[model samples]
Target: MISSVERVRAAYARIAQVDRPEVWIGLRPQEDVEADAASVDARAASGERLPLAGTVFAVKGNIDVAGLPTTAGCPSYAYRPEADAPVVARLRAAGAVVLGTTNLDQFATGLVGTRSPYGAVRNALDPAYVSGGSSSGSAVAVALGIADFALGTDTAGSGRVPAAFNGIVGLKPTRGLVPVEGVVPACASLDCVTVFARTLPEAERALALMAAPSGRELPALEQRRPGPWRIAVPRPERLGELEEGWAEAFGSAAARLAEAGAELLEVDPTPFIEAAAMLYEGAFVAERYTAVGTFVDGHAGSADLDPTVAGIISRARDVPAHRFYADLERLSALRTRALTALGDTDALLLPTTPGHPTLADVEADPLGANARLGRFTNSTNLFDLAAVAVPAGEVNGLPFGVMVIGQAFTDERLVRIAGLLAAPPVRLVVVGAHLSGQPLNGQLLSLGGRLVRTTTTASAYRLYALETVPPKPGLVRAEEGGAAIEAEVWQLPPEGLGALVAALPRPMALGSVELADGSFVTGFLCEPAALDGAREITSYGGWRAALPSLAALPSPAALPSLVRTEGPGLSPPRT
Candidate 1:
């Protein structure tokens, strides 16, 4: 088993190997990490509970950490804080150690990660590629395994874009879910604290700890199998700036979901797109200026802020008071439109980044590029949704992620669903009463089972309605004349097989079952000669439907329901 401390150490080594991404101005001293590790070890020996227990993480420079300087990526505005921000305090109490502060678009102004004065954070996988920002450093740190997780702020796509580009998980919790007390404001109304991690489980654990612990009971986490998943896609007319290859990747991902039993529903994503436009194009850009205008003006002579960031923040100084009110009114109406568009879907899937841009690519059109980066992300906080970015696939080896946005407060449910959708694991085909929603399903569900694509085994096995204590289905491999049977493949952790096998009823056992793809898995295999006058239920493609429907026909109880179909078992087809 891999320990979190070992994971953190590997990440630190990777961060030390390369020149650190220009996204950070400094790092925690080596002596500090050593001391922290010692304390963690002592606690482990003493059996004291440590919530995070040696997990290493980073904070965006703008959020204060005791004894560290708060620069917000702008040196002129740097100030040492006497205490950790509230969010940091909570995480530290949970046993997470802060490694250092990361660089960002100065004052968290730009969406593109390149506007920082320290140095542009390069993509973790490919150096030439620009790391998405203003959460650039945090995303890179997690992507390169520098920390188990890191904290960043998402005013626009700062939290999400970087995760998409670097092949990591970025979670933007509902605004106000994690209080923003002590963090610098970058459009405070829409600003949200974000977390970046390599895996959904790790990210989700951290999210639970960081969320403001409330006494109110949250709904039980919902876990719907992959089939029946309904996703609302962007209206074809609203997709903008998607690169050629990216368009194909999105389509292919959707196709994969369909294969896994999901229903892809296309809805007009125009209202959300229209709301996204309001973030920067309306008065919200002025809010960015409001947060840091005085500093920019006071330090005009000494500040080395990116000229482009400075230019946009300066726009705040020119907005007429009345126009601000008018913009607010329009925004309210747009929010309603957004809610209607998102209704009736598990999540609204969108390209993490419409497209990727390079350092040189962004420098040429900083403003235009930054605006484009937020095309799909700007409305997240504006409309108030919790989202997680997962690595969907790749284009030319660079990562492309999909954002699963759900209604606010359903954050936990979203994470559970995201875990199910992660890359498929070892398949375990079940050919009997163990199907989902069946009595034996509790056994599989207890073992962290995830439904993989559901399908029937090739016609080469025999099924016998086994007469057992609870009445079960017996699937057995047969020679030349076996009929193809119905079954569903599920994924489970390799270590969890023992418990499942131990719970099997007598007569009906676990063995290899051949799937349509000629693959095999641990599934239902029956005893020999169990089939006598058993009525075949081969017409129904799956065990659940076939068995129940067969019960209704003639022998209902007398007619043993047996069919020549693939019997559930975990054995590769005889090739």
Candidate 2:
């Protein structure tokens, strides 16, 4: 493990090397940050299991840090909180050093990063593009290698949009899940504390820490909804607004998900689209106004305030109370329809944003372009859904992404789906001792191997009883006469397969094995030389059947001391 003090210094060094000054609004003194890191190292050295030890994180400025002023991107409205937000406190307790507060759209108002008074947060990939907001700085921080993860609030795509732009993982968890008590809410009721990380597992790790009960800890292995997943996607007709390469990019992403074992189903995009419009076009702005409009109004005409943010909030003051109720009623109905459309589907997959917009694109028509960025994101919080956005592929040379939105409490489901999307599971064929309930089955079990199913190899291999220590079988391709041989198909992560390969004993190796179904998989195979003087057990069809032949056999080469003769009672060789 890296020392936390070194991690802290490395993060500061990265921040200094990056050109985007707007990515951070306030950075805690390096010495102070290093002191916190040293403490984490001390605890870890003393035998404490600090999950986040040596990890660095950045907090969105809207969320309060004990010493840094909560600017919410408006300097005049800044306030120094005496204590860290409950969410921040939880992360700190877990041993993550708070590097500093990052920039965001003022009061988390816009999807476009340009609304911040500090300056537009530039995309880490290419400065010409807008770093999506109001979580822009947080995403950029992770993308720039400054922090392992960063905390951002998501009311409407604030967490996810920036992640797409920066090619990172953004997790906007179930609403009301992460405590938002100390966050400067954009739409208080809809806001969720989200995390931006370079990868999904890291985001899951950090968010798991924040969302676990005060006393109820998260399980070591998260519960995952297994695939083949039933996934829903928007109807093609409704995607007219996607930029030139985005539609194709999304199509490719969906195709890849299908290949990863997700069953794709098309759903009308109407309900979700309409709900998204309501976030800004309907009465939801009333929530935003209620959240921070008072301050914006009081500081009216101040050049320090972002005018677009002021105007957006200012207009909500005219919305009748009845209008807010009516919209709520409308949203209630839309949630039902949206959920219904997504019925039985493990997740709803969509482009993270319609397109990647340039910094100039936002500058030219800030409101319009910003609204478009939330086209697929706004309805998420409104519908009370959990979402995980991950880098998909590039479009027109710019990074593109897809979001897997799932029902509340399906955060782990999204994680699973995203993981498959990131790295498809590998199939491995196991035979002989590696079969379920067999002597060496525990090896695969300890490697996180999942049984896909029991099957048989093609009628082209011969099974032989090798005179090895444990009396193992050697499977070899028959020159002419052969029959199907029983084997089990297993699934494993790519890394697990690699580990298994590296640990295989001599004479046993992995090679292409044809299945009875005309399919091929990487499976356990033995060198032909191993069967030179071995007893052919081909008629038995499988190792399990041939085991009866070795019922009275001793572990000759393995343990000569324990070898028994005709003497009846002896610790029999493991069957």
Candidate 3:
């Protein structure tokens, strides 16, 4: 396997080969990245468990990364942060190495990626299209494989829009679920640190790490159980205007989800549309002003600001304080109405953007194109909901994406659903110690595994109680007359299989195991020699059922290997 350091070096080489300068505003020196990777390697050598060990990542320029200057996509507004943003710090602690800072829409004020003076961030797949912003570069970096994942800020669909344009996963966590300290504010109260990655599990891993510290005083997030999900979407007429092929794209995506077993229902979108309009058309415009109004006022009529962004922030000054308060009242009522509309649905599915516009299209009518892109997304943060943007399919070779929105704290549920929609996962049948709730289950979860269902193997196997410390179970194929054995089937990331298989203890190997349904999946199997004199517990059906008697015996520490081997049927230890 290539070491993490080699991967980082190769990523930088790829970036150099492509030479897309506009995708990044600043990058750590090669030596700096090497140093970070070296530190992660040293930690691994010291036996530390780093969830993101050797993972390379980037940050949207607005979020601080100690040695990098945070420009928020405006050169004049740049400032060198003395420390990393809390999100960055958390990711670093988890062993992710920082590659650099990426470009964005100036001050995070637009959905089109062209507002930065640093230069327009072109689409990763095509140079003629807009990359979407203010997370344009972050999304492009991930799409181009320059980084494993990246951090972006989402105030008004910045994170999600870019993700759609780049065919990547954009996770806009529930507001305040990730601390915003040390990040350059876009709309302060509405701003959320977002994650951009190529897969749902990668995004989920980053979200979990960033969410840990901020969850202290927050309401406990509900753990999502796997089952058939009910998905809500806007009624056809209310889906608003979409680009030429986008409506069909969305319809096809909805149909596929239905075929995959999700129950799809249409709901009136009036409240959500009204709430979305309030973000800029209502008094919430002032929030943008509050974040960077002073700077705009100070730099008024200067060439430092992007005209579109300048015009947007300049309008905030006209919104009176009383208007802001009234809008807040209106928003609260709308939120209640929106929640009522959602009812029992697990999540709301929508097009991430109405269209993917070209650079010329955005330049000709910047505000109109940007507004259309945010039609389905602007309401999410305003309503304090969590959303994930996932690539749905392609329209005439261009990427089309669907946004999965859920009520507050349902981040994990959204990712789980997104994963199912994106691709078929690697299913593994886990028995014995690796079953759910067993001591070794963490190994599966840490490798991005999700429990699919509990089932029993076909009646060709026998279960034996292993006399190892911690007392694991071993399943062996029988020549004749064996009982069915219970097992848990888990879906794991295919890329993690090699490492997982490499870590298995003696006698345990991955092999085809047939389930009661007559289907087969790769699962744990023990060598026949390992089960010679082990106690047969096939009648119990599963490890959980036999756990009680095992728990009642003298602890493994109190009983030596000799005592365990003294029984009548016990065989001598093998070399």
Candidate 4:
């Protein structure tokens, strides 16, 4: 595998020569990137770990990554920040090194990436095609694998449209799930930090790391599993400005969902669409002006900013305060209608972007093309929903993806579903608390799952003491015939198993192992080899009883609130 650092250096080498098309507004020094690479190498050699170790990533110009200037794609508006935004801080903590800040529509005002004065960020797949913006370069960076993932701000599809245009995964997390403290907001209430990654897993990994704690408790993982999920689809008449092949691909995808046992329900998305319009078409545009009004006013004569972007900001100055508040009220009402449309559904399915437009086409009709791209994305923050875009198929040699939208705080659920949608299904047996109704069982259920059987491992395994803080037992398959250990079988939906697997701690993994009934289930297998000289505890059965008792375990009140760091067995909420 190419280390993310190597990929960044490779991209830099290519970008250094005629960097115009990729459009980096805030390129980092080659020396800084090399130093980060050295750090990654040192950490790996020293046995220090990182979930995103050696991974290279980028952020849209609006986000504050320490040492990078916050330009929002306008040179006159640029300013160096003293600290990384919370999202960037989190990613750094997880071991991902920043590549550089990318180009975007000035002040993130345009959906098409061409509005930047630095240079238009071209589509990664083809220079002739437009990279959707205002987070265009962020999307292209990930699409071309220059970075493992890129951070973009989504206040009107700046985060999502570009991913679709570039053929990558765009994760527009639930608004507020990722904080916006350091972002140059296009619409403060609707602005969300989004992630772009080549794969759903990579995107989810980045989301988990960057998401801040919301302080609200999540519904137990098992409780989140709606028994039979309803997946909402827009009524055919409502699919707007769609490309030819997108309709076919979406229909085929829906059929696959039906075949896979989802209850596909057709819904009138007019209310949702109406709500989406509130973002830009209504007074919400005033929020955009509010985000950077002072700067725009101070630099009124700057030729560096895009004229269209400056015009939009200038127009916002005329809106009265009452109109902005009225828009907020209207948006609230629309949110209620939108939520009703998604009621009881596990996810609402739609095309990631209505269609892709070429650079020439976007340049010819900027505003019209931009509005067309937001057809599916404008309502996310307005309705407080979490969403992820997973690649589905292709059209005219360009990749197309499906957007899975779910209720807020259901980010993990969407990821699990996205993973299933992305990869082929696998059958595996689970043991211990992973079984239905068990403490850690929700992880499986959230992915649309069910119990296959209650079984046992083959008579060649010894369960032992593993160093989990809530110390757990690990089963080691032995060549010499050993005692049959108890376990359970699970029938997981094709994309339903990731949320749980992704939560496992270090030294634990999903492995092929025998069951008590002389069968195999993809169950929890431990690196008991890491438990050398540790106590053998197979006689007490599984971790539930063999491990320490919950009664004697420290009460929530007694224990210091240890942030559930990302890894296996931890499902800490993303902010």
Candidate 5:
């Protein structure tokens, strides 16, 4: 394995070789990145497990990273944060090192990556093509291998569109699952932290580390037991606006899914389209205004603001509060109707974007092209859904992608489906301390493990509360009496399996464990002798439920605050 310090050096070397200034707003000094890598290395040397120990990542400029100036793609609006965004902080704690902040559409107001004052981020595959935005640089950074994965914000299609254009995976998590505490809001209520990575597993891993504690009960995810899935697609007429060859490309992808046992059902897209239109055509625009209206209005005609962004915010000022409320009520009705229309379907499959636009194309019809890009995506967050965009194939030598979407909290299900559609990796089932938000979960994450879904083990094993310092679990196969115990299935890189197995403590060992659905996979198991003095807790069903004390641990988002005393000293623009 490459050391973290060497990985950081290689990333810097790649950046120097590419010399793409437009892809970054402000980068951390090389020495700083090396220093971070050294710290990670020291931790590893001391036997501390780091899930993302050698991982390099970049953050969208709108997200604060303590010492860096957050420009949000507008130089004049830059501000130095006293601490890292909750999402960034979580990633760092998981062993990922931040390279720097990448560029985006100014204030994250546009889908076209071209609206930034720092310069339009060009497509990683082709310079003439426009990098999809407002998360432009973050996607480009990952696609170009300058970073292993990058953080992006998705209010509309900012995250997915870029992943499509760059032939990568973009995981737009459910809103509030990943906190937006230190991120500059584009649409405060709709904004979500998104992950961009070359592989689906990598993106999913990042998503797991950043998930926040949701206070309310969320919808249950679609079952993971492999069988036939009913996937919904828009009617032919609804796809009529696709660019040349794109419709054909989409059809081929659907056909591939069918071959993989998916039943494609065409549905009316009216409700979805209406919900999408409501984002800009209805009072939702006021939310954008609510985020930055005061600042833009105070600086009216300043040269610092992008003209398109200024115009969009200016139009929101005239929308009366009553009108906003009316639209909100209308949206509520549409959302209910849309959910009803999608009844019981496993997932909705759609093109990530209607087409890939060129820099010249965006210049010719900026707003129109940008709006088209959001046709299938703008309604996702509005409808309270989760989506994962994966590269389907190429169309006319340009990258194209299909998005897998489901109701909110189905993020892991969507990611699992996406992995199945692409290339399935080795899966490992974890029972106790290795689950997300657990004390020892970092060990799995550092080894490139991603949570697939939380399910139960076959009713043939007994779970025991081991007498350990941090309280671990011991699972033993029982022939006569056993109960299905809650467990989380995770995808792990095959290369890391040996190391993971070798590092297991006394009671735990790698063995085949059957899932509730009778599917078997390599997982953690315990020798019967190890459970001699342990308390049998199979009645509790899962480790989490059995240990009430674990509930008091702070969530990933609520970890200790890190206060930085030094920054780039960029003055905040006067309003």
Candidate 6:
């Protein structure tokens, strides 16, 4: 391992070599930063266990870092912090060295990195393109290997879009999970202190150190969702207006995640997409003005203020409190609807942005270009969801990425699901009680089951309603006159599945169920003995379609019978 001083020295050396002036807004005198690093080495030498010994990182200009001016990208607004923010203080205590503060959109108000007087943060890979923002500089510093990780803020896509463009990891923890005590807020209630790193481990390590132990009002959620994970994504038809090569890139990215053992469930993205629009277009922008409108107003014609940013805040200042409250309620409803659409799924995956925008693209139409960039990102914080953006590969030779989103406080678990995108898939088919919203559906959700898609069996099988206590289905291969029967293919981890097999009761058995697409998966089958006088329901196509006929049947003394529509499962379908 390199000494702290050596690591700090190397970071400065790389910064010099990269020669990206726009990337940093301030620097702690090199000697002073190295002195801090030297102390870290001394502590470690004295047998201290420093978790981040020799680790060097950068802070977004908007965050407080004592001795360095917090310009937040506008020189007129710069001020020296008396001390480090709690998040920074925590990281520093763990033996990490702070190189300096990086540039950002003035007051962290814009999604595009261009809205800063420090000049547009050029893309690390292609200077002509944007680096993504308002975390622009921090992301570029990490992508260039100048810092092991960097701190940035995300109220909208500021933290994620930049990571997608720079080919690194960006973790925007659940809102309020990381304290915003000393950081400048674009939206006080919505801002999050985010981490950017080269890999998942590094990002997770830093976040683990800085995160508040637990006072956030998050529900008790699982961190490790066992495999055959369900990953939600925008339905193909809804992925509107992509750059030339992005559609194909999204398709390939989704396909790769499926290969990682995920069941890609294409879902309606209406609530999320609508929420994204609200972040900037509705009363939400009022939060940004509330943050620094007076200062910008006082500096009216100062060159330090980005005209685009000033214009946005100026317009937002007049928005009445009623509109903000109305939007807040609407946002609340959208959040509920969004999570409900997810059902038992683990996370929502999306292209970090429509595509990488060139500096020229921003110049042509700053608001339009910036708005387009946030299409996939702006909704996250508004809905109070945690997100991670990782490289998905390339789009027309530019860096691209996909974000995994989950309920608030699922940071660690979300990372686990993000990692499981590479696990081998374990597909299973269910014909009756096991189908989605059925009486027995919770059995699958408890074991981390995911609905791959609602499909049907080949035209060579018969589906029968077996008379079990609570009723079940028996799928039998037809000798003749076979008809296609509806079925649902779900995925589960090997262990959870093995347990189900061990607990199999009566004549119900597991066998290969071929789908209409000719794909075979482990599904429910019936023993000949259990088929005695069973009613054939293949004519109904699926159990859901035939459920009306079975509604009158009484549930067993212990187990409830299946209900029509979505049933009473561990998680009912969100309305």
Per-residue alpha-carbon lDDT of model 1 for 258-365, expressed as tens digits? 677767778677766777887878876888878999888776656477787787788778877887899778878887887677666787778877888888889888
TM-score of each: 0.71, 0.72, 0.73, 0.71, 0.73, 0.72
Cα lDDT of model 3 by residue, 1-575, tens digit: 22457547756755764478998899888888988898888887798889887578989999999988999988888899889988999999998899999999999988989999999999876788899998999998887767878999999899899999887889999887889998888789889999998778788889889885455356665554576888887755688777888888888888888888988988787888878888888888888888899999899888879999999998988899899899999999999999898887899888998788899999999988888888889999999899999988888666799988998878878887776568755889887866754545544543445556778999999998888756788888888868889888877655335447655567777899999999999999888788888988888988889888675444423423221232332223221
Estimate the TM-score for candidate 2: 0.72
lDDT of 5 by residue, 111-136 (tens): 88999878989987678898899999
- Model 6, 222-278: lDDT tens digits are 555566878887865697788787777778878877877788897888888889999
lDDT of 3 at 132: 95
User: Considering only N, C-alpha and C atoms within 3 Å, which residue pairs clash in candidate 2?
Assistant: none
TM-score of 3: 0.73
In model 5, which regions exceed 4 Å deviation? 220-227, 424-575
User: Would you give me the overall lDDT of model 6?
Assistant: 0.81
Native-to-model Cα distance after best TM-score fit, residue 501 in candidate 1, in Å: 30
lDDT of 6 at 299: 91
What are the candidates' C-alpha RMSDs? 16.1, 16.5, 14.9, 14.8, 15.6, 21.9
Q: Higher-TM-score candidate among 1 and 5?
A: 5
**Clashing residue pairs found in predicted model 5:** 51-446
> 1-575 in candidate 4: lDDT tens per residue?
23545544555644532244555767788888878877876676677777676577888999998888998888877789999999998898777888889889989898888998888887765677888888988888776546668999888877778887776788888777778898877888778899997667678889888877775566453354546567888855588658888888888777777776778888777776777777777777887788887788888878896888888887887888888788879888877877777766788888877788888888788778878888788888777788887777678766687888888888887776666466554566665545443434434433334344556777788877655544456778877746777676655535345545665566778888876555555778877557787677677666556646422332323322222335553334332
Considering only N, C-alpha and C atoms within 3 Å, which residue pairs clash in candidate 6? 223-413, 260-421, 260-422
Candidate 4 local lDDT, residue 383: 78
